[model samples]
Target chain A: MTNSQRTPYDGIVMAAPVTIPYVRYSIESAQWWIGRALGALVAQAGIKASDIDGLCVSSFTMGTDSGIGLTQHFGLCVRWLDTIPLGGASAIAGLRKAARAVQARDADIVACVAGDTNHVDSFRLTLENFSRFNQDAVYPYGAGGANASFALIARNYMRTFGVSREDVGRIAVAQRANALRNPHALMKTPLTLEQYLAARPISDPIHLFDCVMPCAGAEAFLVMREETAASLGLPAARLLSTIERHNAFADDPMQVRGGWAMDVGELYAMAAVNPDDLDIVQTYDDYPVITMMQFEDLGFCRKGEGAEFVRAHDLTIDGDFPHNTSGGQLSVGQAGAAGAYLGLVEGLRQVLGAAGPTQVRNARLGLASGFGMINYDRGLASGAAIFAGPSR
Target chain B: MLQRCEACGAFAYPAREACPSCLSPDLAFADAPRGGVLLAETTARVPSDVYFRERVPWRIGLVKMDCGPTIVAHLHTDCVEGAPVRMSLQLDKSGQAVTFARPEGETPNMADDRQWREMTADPKFRRVLVTNGRSVIGQEAVVALKAAGAKTVFVGVAEPWRPFAGEDLLRRQEGVEVVTLDAADEKSAADLAADIGGKVEILVNTTEYVRAGGLLDRKGTSIARDEIDQAYLGFINLAQAFGPAMRMRGADGINNSVAWVNILSVYALANWPAFGAYSASQAACLSLSHCLRAELRPGGIKVMNLFTGPVDTEWFQTVPPPKVAPRAVAQAIVSGLKNGLEEMYVGDVAEEIRQRLAANPKALERELDR
Candidate 1:
């Protein structure tokens, strides 16, 4: 389908991006962090908890509970509700679902939230039963979880494109530098290029710094009619376009490219922008290789030119190209499904002039992309969203 | 086993419900082409599960099978990225099928690869226990295990005072150690366990009491009772005595406890009227082995069942020709352990019965009855 056939996301606006601060480990459950994010959203939007008639919840550690159970746990009623378990793709995917609900008048306000608690052993437990394909086909081999899966992808990508460890290090080093400016990012120390290169390997070619630190946290944003947001006097960002795809290119032996490449032409066409038009871009950074894939697939660079693109452009928040302005998941810490929304939340804040220390200058237009779910050999979900300042 | 979609001609792994391409439910199991290319590989230093954690630094690979599917396989150290490779399906410690990748051509010490070593319970350098070495099959099993590199073969000669033709043959084997234990006596098993249970790595149960009579053909239940005591009850005594020690030492260094071998009969799948009581006892032992498999799975210990057709021993002399030899059955057991196969059908008749049972159980049941 062409981009012209799709209806524009005209009146819906995303506002009140709330991050519940990542902790290396938490004694609390997923509900505790999700509840905090929801409460934070209500207080930040200056609306009563009951005003949100819709909810979109995403989490990996929510045992025997979903979006429906969450409403009762938090004491509210909703006309529209959903629970997205799409790991790193949950944020953009959840936002798109909430925006459509608002446009259809099914709910006046929809709260899109994702959260998970890392209880020291939760990451390992989650990987054990992540999916049927993963358990039967992938885990039995080495039980290496995502680390081993991504290592293969990184190694293949490096060999095919002649990308070096230094190229990958550049993305990580810049993200760590951006993390230093992000108050809520879990990594507080500065990182050197030498440190990233010299970091110990968890799986060959995937060093300690190349991987994200699993943590406990939550992120939430509200999707409502632009008029409703204006009436509430809440700062907001307008949705230009959003696209999501699952299990695309299942036949690719090597997953160096993601689903974004399948419909990227339409994503940019509907948003009516070129690659240069994006003042800020936030690509999911579960690993530095993913960011490089997003750069190639999202039209920031040609296929196999991700190395050249990162080499030529400065990715720091104050540099020529400001990417992952909130330090992304690699620096902020991957909080289960909350990691999926990391890039989208940062993109929304940037366009709304709300990103405090890591805000890009004159960030009027922004793009966020997500890739996730290594169900077996490779990741299976991809999504992206373009957001613009309310004035734009 | 590999599945090929009838509609789209595509191959799928992990047994898909429908064709991955055309969404057709019509799928056929076929032998897969072994050819494949190693797309990528890694050495996992940190494992998500405890079973692999003990065997850290496991080699893993992603391969694009020549047949059409991409598979995640255990990698041999010789398997290089972007190089041609071949695949084999080996049962992991869980007794579930896991594909493995190796070099296209044979490599030196391929069997010594860590992934291969972990999956296969090769008797190499590990201690073993063979029960009731008085039986021809039992004595042969002790010999086979020793030839496969077992450091010590503890042959349990039940009723030690009773003279057997092959008793001297078993006692003279280089690595063979004679121990007195009666399969029917619970105390004997316990006494043996107290002596060597802590060190026995592989336990091969080869006790059998064969009587050629159906239930209705026998007036008294004494013959049936003896069969149950040897095949069914004797299994419990051995499992209880040695199982705990073996399970506890699953992750104990390189020569850790690995497998429990159950020598059973093909008749266990479907009873033969000629030996109904014996078949029933075999069936009961098979069921218990499944339970033991689950219990020992967490420790990564394998429970391998070697099912053979009618043996050429005196008990099966009246049955028919093509009966598997006791020495040959012993060789099959060692081979199954080396290949990490959970269920192995040895000999022509055993393999034929296995195939017929899979294709049509009711037909095989009727045919075996006669």
Candidate 2:
């Protein structure tokens, strides 16, 4: 809790299983998946579950009742707990929360996790069902899922942000190309602006390819005091700083501009860092539109210059700023809760010199984010976490 | 194309005779703009004996008109939930209804979907099943699911069960499983419950049994059946059979107990029907939901009920109605189940009910003939 330079705490260990249950998502599965993943991490790190002092989880489908209840079910003896409800942003938020707990001496070791139902039908259910966002103003208007609604926002974003339809397509194309190098990516096909634009639009500016595939999976990590991490001989990453805010219905009242993008500056400030200091960054990208906005908001490049960044600069490992080296949600296969964690894991591995192919060279610091609860016409609820290299 | 009524401030699809709000005969036709969010959509199955079996599992949607109104339009692609749709003037194949397509950058051409095909075709997999009543859409969804290579069974729920009956429809679809239960009484409910003692992967309850006819022809009046208590029996019976069956199965499988789908007119949820008995019965059905949810949570059951409005069925066809379709209602219900929802309000009526319930708690009692 210092100025621009926040003191380093302990190293955080993140872990997760690669697979998502194909069946419909349920509370039991959520707890099961999370517990299994965490158990593996505990064994790897050589720590007892009870010895872990804090727990944090993020999931779109797991409600509060289910999230809190999972603690007892998982048999985690922890003094602190945090449940994050943002869609793709959950993992990053959990990390930040764990960082705080570690810094506060709330716990010596913290576990962060995510999970979801990978079933396509259930994906359909999550959208058409009485979602947290669409219970009222949306369903009656035939605004189906986040894709359709975000398309509307993307349409307006393109208009307001001065991004050409090609620019959006460019992002999709580039991400797909980047995903090709990552084996875990869902989409690896090389894409072009022509192919992107030629594709049929699900909504105005949003194309089918412009959105990430609905995936179900989980990811996790462990965070503990730096001294303890080294003493245990565990690989680690530094949690620099974090921040979270809820902007429900920000667009409805027309009080705010760019729901998720609105607070990029604030997020950077909370982390006591700027977009410039990061060697790598991971934004919770359920859609390409949100991805572009993250760049603009996070100060990676400039506002409405996201498309330019993709086209002009190289975000690939060989390029200037490395992004979604794991192919991101676009290619990385978004398994809901674990997706963000996957990004964080990849980031940590890069910083730890562990990523085999998708690694950003000489990576020392990384920033991760999660955005969720697409209320009204925008995504107001978001969480951000900044991480630095494991102190030598 | 559908248009919003100048009088009622609501969207109307297929152009209607009068404003459903005010009895104004000043109906104006308007085009449903392309490029609206897909609020909800589903696929449906047709009997082989039916003429449109080839189109059996097709996609249809409750599209929001960019202007204001909402219409049930055909979803051209296999994409149900997140797929964006561009409204356009197309032949309403079903009954002069308008349709739309994906706009530019909306969807990739079929050939470009090589990766999607490769991913979908894997045997070990992850797959999602989305239904459409139209065979074209249904086939597309199936193709997509198959291409994803996930073990998927996307069943299309058809509309109008009375004339053909749910059992008869189940009989026609070979290799498909069926859970039959009456939507009107207790004995049938018990029988259905016994039949489905355990084996069930996904349990969806979409049975609505209501004796329709205005309670009062005039501005306000009362009708019987409110005291009869027959309607309540169907819901309870079906829940007993299916809800428990899902619980018995695996906690991971989805259990959707959808009740009160597209049967209400404006008076039902809000106006406080003149038929107090019917209203009371339906209200009671909704009340039992809380307890069932609590009891089933330990079993990992995800329960969702549909509080839907009018649907275009044999019942609605005979009576004048809004731009409602039976197929549309079915699609929405299935979509809700996919998102892991607990409750879904099909149309604007849900909001109307909330308003009435919050604004005037006693407004529902006005229908009582007391």
Candidate 3:
């Protein structure tokens, strides 16, 4: 691919996420959450909803409605539209699609939103019919749900790498401490290592703290030309490089890593930056073990040294390795599809100097990685983006 | 059965129509080897479905079969992670084929094989008969059967003249037929059996004679005799009466009976001396049910034995805390029937007792001795 085709957008101007929390049960539908995110995007960007010529949306419970239906419902005549259902990887997926669309001049302003509402039965129903493979293979075995599947991976990771629960517990406790500064975070209470270790096991090897609390929320961002963002006087984050891979390393007996391992070199090469150069790192923290895996796969550490890396680094917002500064989904509450966008939006916020209390000092360049869609035993989609603040 | 791709020689689980590898439509089904290495295991303390809520703390494992396929299957309690397991295919409650793995040399047809029982649990459109309908558990069973879409529910009353709390409600419900029969009386049981044996698809014996006391109590022997007369003889009479007809029906291909459920107590598994005679009678009943289960296995009629602890009923009004609600037990029975579980330990106390027995029987025995 040509450089223009590869790094299409001059920059991405992301809006503050419209997050709704603690709605463990909601009467509203997926459309309402998506619309709310769109409203927030337009208001934050100081643009009219009608000005949005490109639309990209992601939701798990949207039910037969993709970008086409969303366009009609929101009364938008878009030149480009995409529906990313990549779960945690959706935010980066949406950004990549919208960025390419803008570069191609298909649309000037693209509104990319990912949101979902959690109802009493939505979580269970979603798992039951997640996929034919899950329904037939994984679900029937004790109906262990997602926790059980992740438990298998966590156990194997520990056994293979000699990682202890204390090593993983450090991530959760640190993230909880970070969530204390995030007003939008659901779990603001201080989490001690003792508490994380003692928390009841949902599935063996995965405790309550190890699992993400499913809530209802959304996050959105606006992608447009550099001239457009400059005219609006909005601070923009330059999209240095983004990479996505699916079903990578399908031969592993159990997932000790993700697709990021396969493409991290390409991502760093394209961005012209080393892993050590990034100011802040935002990883998909669906589980602490996954965060450790991302750190290794994204080239922050050597393979099989994730546990050692985690043990050696201080991961709190103010620490040496500023990671998941906005508390991540672990504390922010995973709002269905919004989980995919959480890290990307946070990365944008960090680069733009909008991350209030959890802001890393002198934050300039940031890395955001997403992993999602556990089709059966392991997550299939992985995407990451490196963003740089606009030149002073 | 597992599917193999003729083009690439790759084997796939769930018997897919097309090859996942090589994109070959020429896939063929063949018998899978009964051996696999247990890759991982988890004790699911939380359940995601309504049917599994009562059966929490179930062991599930991922097994990599020797034939180049991995399957998520129910693991036998004896099987641990990293151990080699023998695999067998069994249908789940949804009528979908599911693999079950057990420790090697443990026959899949063993009496404690839970996977074999789950295959027979779905109670949709099956005709049901609940013996001893006067009690709370019996009434709940009838209600659960109706909710599960049983075509017809026959409520067998041992004492027709006695007043029961839910008896009138049961008689008033649609599709419920109340019949009179004394389980201890062979003639009455035979007469009732002759009446509805052909039509009954799910038979549940909830008869119990519990006189709570230790062996030192003056009336203990009489209580034990009555318990034996009612619990054991009652189950035997019902099984003998229904087993023949159920087998014949299975042979006839017209409404083959699905299962026979016995609501015994957890004490039967590990004799709790506090309820000495009651426990002894329940133990006898449990043994008889196993024999009956084996006898009816050829006809595909599952025998579901429920081992529950103290339930919230008049029989256990004095039993404090940790008692299971009658509706919960009833729901469990219906779920058990639908899932075709051979043996189910319901209620928190029962599950605790089960785990205790599995972990250290001598410790449990010593505690009971105290």
Candidate 4:
């Protein structure tokens, strides 16, 4: 398809996000959380489950079952099905795929859901077998898990950019403040810079505050034509643009930036907006260093200046930047694959004027980005999307 | 070694079969660059797998080599991030090609040296000599050494008049030589050393007298003298006679002696009153072994000392149920010789005593006294 003929996602709306609260550990399975999320999405949309003709699912703990098995279990038939196993980037990937399918008249309504259950052994098991490269190369050193890998990145970033621990502490403290206002956030207690710095080091340079608490939960959203959303009497958040890239800089000895840096300009150009136009920003906050990298790579600042960007901006809901209003994964525990959808679902809630306590005033345009799958030393998948309110 | 593609001039690490960039089968293996830059480093305080659990606080890092391959290598503790490092590939305990990086100007640790690893490999197809071969430990060592593929095994018997239970079977075995020599007699040791000095690649000394008594025993003086004569002086005479020949063989590069193993009692570290004289003799042997190790370093001969608890031998027949089996001790000796370890503790009690002594020697002494 030509660029002109390729469908723009301006009128493709994402509606009816159903989020389940994150629990620290559970014996429940992925199917349980996914069923709850799908059920909640249909209930919030005030539609029958059979009305959904397309499905896109994301889950790391969903053993031996893909979209085909889920379709059979949920008893919903559709022409489009996608199982985006992109870890934390699955949200944007699922949305991009479902939006294109709808634009192509493949399926009218698509249910996008990401969920996972975290047992006591789930996080350890996931890290042990995350990927072949990770299992062989990284796991043998020390079971530092993701914290070890991220710590190395954080150390490199600090050494390169002169970023201090306090610079990242600012993000953690601010996000915890936002989490206090978020009912779905697992960690609602106020966090201070002193506490962030004083926390015990899980890995050197990556303290307790820098790591996300792995928990069990689910997040879901519905992707359909804007007219169909309007007909259902639901407020719609239009997806303006989305970009996903993997293994972007294979030559970099160390990952100072992510794949977002490679495709972020195209993301903004396609949406006809700049970073300044964003009323709210939701970045995957598995680690604050990563958020800083996203800020620099997504064109908020120059390369290697993420620390300065973090220092300059106050990222609370009431602050000028208004980033991660739903507390991000720092305060809101990460629910395996659902972490990819957490920011997207929250961004949709903000633009649709449905974010209860953490909502920003007159939030017309928003940005949500994701990163996932640290297969070896660096994250391989990165994606971002811009959404707008009905006025746009 | 690193592989280079003839078609595209691209380098691939771990010796891939084909070029990753050009998919060409024309690949050549060549020596990897010695220079590398330390990209990032971390000490795994909590090791993820069982293999590294005991070796916690392991320093590992990513090193980008000048030849264009980034490797995950065990970092020398002194190597700083962002600094240039000397890198090389070595086989780990699991026999995998593991990269190791050290700071410039610092010698590579013996643990990460390929030559050291090869030198410590099993004494396969090598001629071996076991002193005091008529004893229980010596017979077990003979069986284990033969099983490990020794080309010829010499059993040095001090007293042929007293027939050992396995002596007939040992004599009937192929490539087994039963030599008559008393370790206490200097002439006998020198004569035996002269006969097989050039061919013997592994020499084991399991000669020890178990005179179990405290310092105040009525026969303590004679017992201590016998123990010293067998354990300490015996090793010294054998080394003095055989060492020169071993060094000459090494100089001439004719399958020289690679290892000298000494089996001693764990009481050498922390003396138990019941075995005080034996402990004193073994302690002296340990000291002499260290000196021998330093002296033999120029000739590339490894000195391995095995400190073990009481074994279920005739000498330790009255020892408690926790005594180690003779076969186990023999196996430990073979492994220690193969791995080229400077020192090893055999049996649970021996390891425990070693740990206790390391933690606090005074406390261990007090515990042994009690």
Best by lDDT: 1
Model 2, B1-370: lDDT tens digits are 4555767665554445776556677666655455666655533332111222333443444555566555445455544544566665531211122344343255555312321211111212322222222222233233433443334333333332534334354335433333334445566556544654443334343334444444445334333343233345555655565566555542231222211121233334553343334455556666676666666654445445566554455533443455345555545544543333455566665556556666776854453223
TM-score of each: 0.95, 0.52, 0.70, 0.68
Candidate 3 stretches with Cα past 4 Å from truth are A1-22, B107-370
In the range B1-370, model 3's lDDT, one tens digit per residue, is 7888889988887567788778899988877678998888877878787656656777788888888877888887778788899987765544356788878875554533544444554566678888878888888889998998878999889778888787779889998899997888888889998888888888888896776776886543666778878889888888788888886554343345777888989988888887767888888988888798778876667778888998887778777888988788889988777555677888899999999999999899778765
- Displacement of the residue A287 alpha carbon in candidate 3, Å: 1.0
Ten-residue segment with the worst summed lDDT in candidate 4 chain A? A1-10
Residue-by-residue lDDT tens digits, candidate 3, A222-335 = 887777788887788877788999999887878998999988887887778889898999999999999989989999999888888988999988899999998999998988
Q: Could you tell which candidate, 2 or 3, scores higher by DockQ?
A: 3
lDDT of 3 at A28: 90
DockQ of 3: 0.46
Best-to-worst lDDT order: 1, 4, 3, 2
Cα lDDT tens digits, model 4, A1-392, are: 11323357867889997799889998999999999999999999999998899999999999899989999898888888999999989999999999998887798899999999998888888988988767666675556778878878888888888889998889989999999999889997899899999998776878889989999999999999988898899888988888999988988888999999888777887788989999999999999999999999989999988878888998999999999998999999999999999999999989888898999998889999989998878899999999998865
> Which is better, 1 or 3, measured by lDDT?
1
Per-candidate clashes come to: 1, 61, 12, 4
lDDT of each: 0.90, 0.55, 0.82, 0.84
